[model samples]
Target: MVKKTDVLVIGAGPAGIISALTAKRYYPDKNILVMKDVKNGCIPCGIPYMFWSLKNPDDNKLGMDSLKKNNIDVILGKAVTVDRENKIVAASDGEEYKYEKLILAFGSNPIKPPIAGIDKAGIYPILKDMDYLKTVIGELKDAKNVLVLGGGFIGVEFADEFSKISGLNVYLAEILPRLLGNSFDEEFSVLAEEKLKEQGVQVLTNNKVTEFLGEKKVQGVRFDSGEEIKIDGAILGIGAVPNTDIASNAKLGIGKGKGIWVDEYMRTSDPDIFAVGDCAEKKDFYTRRRASVMLASTATAEARIAGANLYRLKVVRENKGTIAIYSTYVDGLVLGSAGLTEQSAKKEGFEIISSASETIDKHPGSLPGSNKIQVKLIFSKHSGILMGGQVVGGISAGEVINIIGMAIQQRVSMSELETLQMATHPYLTSAPTMYPIVIAAQNAAAKV
Candidate 1:
């Protein structure tokens, strides 16, 4: 049987759902349908919380009620092929859907490194599917020792969550010298390591897992230094690769990063199709080089662009490359990084000045729940324009980095930031006289 839709979005992830809903809002008269292989999808970021804070995987499920309320159709099936010549998508079961405009948000797959015994039964890779994660959670229920490979956000979060369970020994191993090496500076990364260590997690840095030891199931891991650690199970969070098989099969243009090549308006080489999310190629905001950032936030932003411009360019917005904004919480501390770090700017050969300030989040330093907030701002020495920022503090740090992101996007300079105005309350924020961001900008300006 053949089905027809005005806009067909393949994949029900953040990108796919946002794109379909955005299309529905822009083109109210059109029929929009989103299809994915999984019937129940868990919130991607909330997956780690399921092990402890959330109790079960089902507790972190992503609901389709919003799609239903917007009159968007949802289908549960895996798309096997895309016939771009006829603008049709075929499912494995021989079902077909014809579309006027197609959006590919096929997402990504976890990367499994070529290590010996990697295919053991007790080894699991982080997946977005609900059922698969539930099974993994079940398997980990009786596990006393768990090893998590990779020190990225996913791996750190998994290690933290798994460590929360009583009697479970969680070990996090990373090849990099510090945790969160790609996003934050050494200071921030070291702080994360310190915090994780305080939480009873064995944090190993600059170590390579050469082999997974086991007979039929993973029992432990051997490091390059000839050290072995016994583990009941292992979770691989090394990274992910874009799922562009269908796009490649359809002869769509692929980027250097192995993602579907897309223009600023989220259009593929073929005008009738568009791509977004983890499966779509991204470019760096500063260098304009192809980047491999696959965050759900970035995906939703791209989806909005593609959805609005499906029929015509109604929205005047376009993606200006990726800024790579990231934030995470380990224990009670919140860490956020936006744009480039000091190390990244220096590596990129930019003459940069960095300034850091430490202050209490609440005024007077005597308020209850007050925490020390640290802000680091990086600026171009020549232009004095804000290039990046990092924050480590209480819950407010998450939103503070967003302000710095806007500064980078709008090309705000240190001078402008020094005199920036913000509303402050004694209970909510630091004193107006000693705001961390403003002070940090002032320090940078003095250096300039």
Candidate 2:
């Protein structure tokens, strides 16, 4: 039997949901269906918060009420295969869906280290399914010693959250010399590590997990240098693997980075097929090189573009590139970064001109609850254009990186930033005379 729909979106992640909703908004009468492998998948970004911020697992649930309110059908099943020629998708439950346009928002999977004993009962990888999350929560509730593998955002966030539980021993390990080495500059990395340490998290750098030693469940992990650290459980947050097997089976062109290759319009090799989210390849905004960024924010933006242009290409958003903007908060301190780090910039063969400024987030430095703010700007010494930026400060750090991202996207010259106007208040932000962006730009101006 043949099922019909105007657009079929597989995977009800942020990208999938946004695509379906956008399609429904644009084509009100069109049929829209979303297939999610997990019946109850929590929002990926909110999963780490289950440790401290959220009292219960249900707090992280991504309610489907918005989708239901929009008249979109959500199927609770995994898609088995796609018949591109027939324009149909077959679910594992013998159900079939036919669509005029197919959007594969199937997100990525976490990369589980193939270490011995990883399959033990106490090892947990970052997963979207809420069932596993509940299991993890139960296990961790009684876990006194928890080891977090990796120092990326996920690992750091997990460590920060788990460390909050009274009496729980939390350690965040990384092979690199700095935490968030891939995104933030050294100063910001140092500051972040300091904050993580202050939050009762044991920060370990230049270390790697060698083996998981346990009989029934993880008891401890062996370091590469033959030392061992006892732990009740382990959270592997190294990286992720994109979900592209179905696309591969359907002969979709995959990029060298192992993500599905799509054009500016998000169209895969097959004109009728499109890929977005963590499974899709993206270009670097500054370097024009293939980038492997998998932020939910990036995915949703891509979904918006893909959904709006799926029917007749109404929007003209080219996947011009990804800035890889990233942000995370811990114990009320927010850290944000955009584009490349100083190390990455140098590695990419660019002569970097960098500047940083540290001042109070609020004016007068005496405002109640005021905290110090640090901003770093990196630019090409020759071109004098903003290549990257990092901010460690106030509650606004979460959104402040957008300015840096925009600067990188627009290739804003350092000279143009000196005269830029930014609003500020004595209670809310730094004085206009001490604006971080302009201040950092001015510092760069001296050397450039």
Candidate 3:
């Protein structure tokens, strides 16, 4: 049957929810509907915290109140296929939706390792599903020893959360030379690993999970280094696979990196169909290469573009390409990064000059809760343009690197950051004289 809406959004997480709300606001007279695969979705970013940090799994439940208030329809069903020519979406429940324009905000799924015994009863992969999470949590509660199968942020966060149990044993394993190798430099990555170590979590890098032992449930893990660790449960957080099966099945162009290819306005090959969130392939702001950077921040940006330009010509205010900018806390230290790392810049064949500064977050240094802050800025030696940056220490580290991300996005040069204006206070920020970004840029300028 033909049911129609002015705009239809898929997925109800950050991207889908934002797109539905924005579309309704932009075109208030138009009917908008958001189809959610998850009957009740948890906050995407807050899923890790729910393992132990939250008292109840439902604590992270996203309310449909906003959609109802905005007069946008929210449909609870999985999108099974999209027909661009016909402008219809076939949901798994056999409900069909017809749309004048559609926004694809379906997110990603965890990429399970090819290692044997991955299907064992005690093995679990992190997906944003609530029922799956509840089952995993129930199993973890009875597990005395847990083997975390990746050293990425999700893996570490899971390991740390699981470690909250008094007698729970947690071990983190990574195949990279260092944990968070793709996100931060060795120094920052090493510091994060060190903190996890102090948290009573085993840190193993430069190792591969070769096998999982036991007939039904995971009893132990074997590493390529000939090391075996006994455990009752295993959680895999290695990486994500974009949920682009519908896109691929529909014959939309997929990128070399395996995500649905999208342009500046989040438009897929078939302009009638747009893809967003972790399911969409993002381009690097600087290099224009396919970017593997996946974050809710990036997803929201794409949603804005898709919502605004769904039926109209592209909007110029926002470029869909994003610099990889993100921050996460490990143990008590906050670590953040934007653009490329020093090593990445060198490997990318750019002549790079870098500088760093170490200082306390507070000017007086006597503040009760003051934390030390370290800032490093990398730049093109020839042009003095900011290429990337890394910052650790203090809670503000979460947002500080975003300042660098913006700089990189706008291609701001060292000269711009050196003269950057920032609000400062002993209680809220670093002293004016030692503002982290400006000071870090100053040091990089000196080297250049």
Candidate 4:
């Protein structure tokens, strides 16, 4: 069957959904269609919580109500090939879609490293599909000892969630020296390790898994140092690679990071097509260098830009670059990082100054539900412009890092942050006199 649409979006993940909705908003008269392989999609970030926090995998399902409400057509099929010259997308089920404009949001796939016994029945890689995860969750209910490989956000979060199961021994192994090495400094990383330890999760750092050992199912893991840990199942959260096979097959320009190359306007080499989300290549906000950061927030932001400029160019709607901001909760602590870390900035050969301050989240230091909040801000030593920031604190830290993100995005200077005015309340925020962000900025200014 032949079908036609004004705008065709592939993949129904965050990027695809947002692109369809945003396109409807900008070009109300245009007919938009979204095609995805999976009927029920799981929230990418919430996948870890399905083991315990969420009642079931279905609890984290992404609904199609929004797509239906916007009058967007949703098709269930995997796109097999893209005929860019003719603006036709061929699906696996012998269906063809013709469009005037196309947006690719094919997302990504989990990185499955080749290791001995990796194909064991008890081993699972985190996937965004609901049905696959539901089966994994059912199997995990019987698993007493589960090993989680990799210490990034997904691995750490899964380890924490699995630990919540009664009598389940959760072990998290990271090849790096610390958890969250890519997003945070040692100080913040240490705090995360400490939190996970408090939850009774075995935190293993600077260790690499040599092999997954078992006959039919995973029974244990052998580390590089000749140490072995017994386990009933294993979850691989090492990382992900972009799903760009179709795009590559179409002869679209591929970026160094193996994602579809896109310009500031989110347009690919072919002006009629655009790419967003995990499938699209990203550049660093500071260096303009190709970056490998992928986040749903960044994806949606790119989608908005692509949707706005789908037909006519919207000069103000172009994407500047990815800032790589991230936030995660372990136990009861909230940790967030935005822009570059002090370690990363120094590694990039930028002379930087860092300042940190610790304060209670509420005034008088005695309010109910108050907790200690720690703030760290990084600035260029010569330019004194805000380069990055990290926060470790109570729930408020989640939003506090966003303020710092805004600072980094706007290139706000240290002096400006020092003199910045913010609203505060005794119960809702830190004391106005000793706000951590302002104090941290003041400290950095003094260093300058």
What's the TM-score of each model vs. the native? 0.99, 0.97, 0.97, 0.99
Scored against the true structure, residue 332 in model 4 reaches a CA lDDT of 76
lDDT of 2 by residue, 221-288 (tens): 99888889899998999999789999999999999889999888888998888899999888787776
Clashing pairs in 4: none
- Report the C-alpha lDDT of model 1 over 1-448, residue by residue, as the tens digit: 6899999999999999999999999999999999989888989989889888986568899999999999999988999999998889999878999999999999999999999999999899988988988899898889989999999888989888887899999999999888999899999989888989999999989899999998998889999999999999999999999999999999999999999999988999999999999999999999998887889999999999999999897547788889989899999888999999999999999999999999999998899999899999999999999999999999989899999999998989999999999999988998999999999999998886
Model 4 regions more than 4 Å off = none
After superposing candidate 2 on the true structure, give the runs of residues whose Cα lies further than 4 Å from its correct spot. none
Clashing pairs in 1: none
Overlapping backbone residue pairs in candidate 2 total 0
Off by over 4 Å in 1: none
- List the global CA lDDT of all models: 0.92, 0.88, 0.84, 0.93
lDDT, model 4, position 80: 96
Candidate 4 clashes: the total is 0
Top lDDT prediction, candidate number: 4
Q: Against the correct fold, how does model 1 do in TM-score?
A: 0.99
Winner by TM-score between candidate 4 and candidate 2: 4
- Over 1-448, each residue of candidate 4 has an lDDT whose tens digit, in order, gives 6789999999999999999999999999999999999978988989998889987568899988899999999989999999987889999999999999999999989999998889999899988999999999888888889999999988988988887899999999999999999999999999999999999999999999999998898889999999999999999999999999999999999999999999999999999999999999999999998888989999999999999999998999998889999899997799999999999999999999999999999987897899899999999999999999999999999999999999999999999999899999999899988999999999998887
